[model samples]
Target: MAGTELFGTIEMVDVFLAMAITIVIASFVSLYRGIEGPGIFNRIIAVNVIGTKTIVLLVLIGFIYERPDFFDIALLYAILNFIMTIAATRY
Candidate 1:
């Protein structure tokens, strides 16, 4: 209802969907970096970046679907991602 009818022909949901797709593509690039990075720290940072992207993608999906629950899930994932990154760095 918020983004709808604002683009004259294109909807806000479409915009959000496009953003989500773009994020996915960027995540793939991060994945490549994670696999082919020259150093372990680079790989770890790439993985962390991917995780951050995932959280954003999740939020966009939740907005597109009009589900507040997704926000909570994304927040939980963010916490887990942070913990994992810290543990990986410590190890």
Candidate 2:
């Protein structure tokens, strides 16, 4: 039991680290797309997609840290992102 628990803890840490790295990379890509995109709509779509990805990444990080409350934040972010995307598209 002790060994299994230790291994699980290490795995969680590894997952968290990997997610953090991915978030950084995604942010960079989002920035690049926003700056180099051909037009305004493309940049807006890229940013919206980045927002969704960020929410998922946050949820995964919360799980890794053993905190369920973070899921609530992720849910709220998803809702807000959806609303904003729709608004942006309509305008």
What would the TM-scores of all predictions be? 0.92, 0.80
lDDT on C-alpha atoms for all candidate structures: 0.93, 0.81
Steric clash pairs (candidate 1): none
Residue 81 lDDT in candidate 1: 96
Q: After superposition, how far is residue 55 of candidate 1 from its true place, in Å?
A: 0.8
Could you say which candidate leads in TM-score? 1
What digit string (tens of lDDT, one per residue) describes model 1 on residues 47-85? Answer: 899999999999999999999999999999999999999
Global CA lDDT computed for model 1: 0.93
Q: Per-residue alpha-carbon lDDT of model 2 for 35-85, expressed as tens digits?
A: 899998989988897898889788877767778899999999999999999
Query: At residue 25, what lDDT does model 1 achieve?
Result: 99
Give candidate 2 regions above 4 Å deviation: 1-10
